[model samples]
Target: MKIRNIFKGILIGVPIGVTLIDSLGYVARVDGISMQPALNPDQDQTDYVLLNKWAVKSYQVQRGDIIALISPKDPSLNIIKRIVGVQGDIIETIGYKNHIVRIPEGHCWVEGDHTGHSMDSNNFGPVSLGLITAKATCIVWPPSRWQFLSSSLPESRLPLNLSPPTLLYSA
Candidate 1:
């Protein structure tokens, strides 16, 4: 009787734990130097961040947000990048074939802070919004590095066209 109850608990508890992680958020390790100073500032020590899946459930993302997504080139791989342009915004490419690109509906331009050393939208073009998995909200590991990630884009990386203000008249 005791063994049977233990087995039952495992089955019930495992699913609930998985559901919470899937719907809420989980910690993920930063692997490469692509994210650079914002992520793995030191080459020797890696950072672990909390990826909030629930925050992006609606597919709404802002420019400068660091997000994780399935690699367009390799479906099996996941990559983290900063959103450079959202739908309808124009982006000037670094080394991409096209000098300028306009993010199409349901697509966003992503790039790594490390630039030349990273593989990102410059190599794959804009990625579909559906590919985005989660937003990195904060660093959870290394107590000294604990802090919320800020959503701020480099002035030079701002999109050519921003969405018009909804309020026509300001006070």
Candidate 2:
């Protein structure tokens, strides 16, 4: 009887924890140097960042927001990248096959701060909104690294033209 109760408690606790993490936010360890000065900044120790899921639930991601998404080529993996272009905006690709691309409906273009080292939209193309898991709101760990990540796209990365009706659709 005790064992059964313990099992029940674990099952309930697990889901609650997962839901809280999904709805609220959680800290994740940075494994690579893709984000450069914005993230790890160093080669020795890593940083743990707070990823906010609440902010992304509306699918209203803005340019320069650091977001986490399930990799398109490999759905099993999750990658962190900055939003370079939103739907309806025309973006000039970096190393992508095409020189310029208009972010398709329900999709957004992502890129890494360290251009050459990171694998982002330049490699796999724009990602669907459904694939985005969360937004990196701030760096929570490491006292020296604590700060809110602001929305500020590099001037070179901005789209050439902004479409007036990005969210419009005709049924």
Candidate 3:
């Protein structure tokens, strides 16, 4: 009886915990220095960021937003980067094969703060919207480092065309 009750409790608690983390958000430790000063500022201490799953549910992510996505080259790996260009925008590549690329429909170009160390869209090209998992809203841990991650793209990394694509509606 005791063993059965313990197993039942585990089943209930596990789902609830996972659901909360999936629907709401959760803190994750910063692994690398790709995000640089914005994330793992100190060498010894790693920051924990609050990734907001609810925000990306619609896949309406904007330029400059910090997002977590499944790596195109390897589906099992997850990488965090900033959106440099969205669908329909023409962007200039860095180390990618093409010198210039037009962001495809339902795709976005992403890059890391520490450009050289990170492997982002610049390496594998634009990522499909379906690959995105969540948006990094803020750095929640490290009392002294708490801050909302702003959506600001570096001037040097801005897309060639800043205009939005035209959409036609038919009834």
> Which one wins on lDDT?
1
Tens digits of per-residue lDDT for model 1 on 43-121?
8888999999998999999999999999999999988999999999999889999988999999999999988989999
Candidate 2 lowest-lDDT run of ten: 162-171
Ranking by lDDT: 1, 3, 2
Question: Cα-based RMSD of the predictions, in order?
Answer: 5.5, 7.2, 7.2
Clashing pairs in 3: none
Kindly report which residue stretches of model 3 are placed more than 4 angstroms away from their true locations once superposed: 1-11, 163-171
Put down candidate 2 lDDT per residue, 118-162, tens digits, no spaces.
Answer: 999999999999999899988877888899988778777889795
For candidate 3, write residues 10-117 as lDDT tens digits.
999999999999898888777898888678978888888898989999999999999988889988888888999999999988889999999999999999998888
Best TM-score among the predictions, by candidate number: 1
What is the number of residue pairs that collide in model 2? 0
Better of 1 and 3 by TM-score: 1
Question: Which runs of model 2 end up more than 4 angstroms from their true locations?
Answer: 1-15, 162-171
**Alpha carbon lDDT of each predicted model:** 0.92, 0.89, 0.89
Off by over 4 Å in 1: 162-171
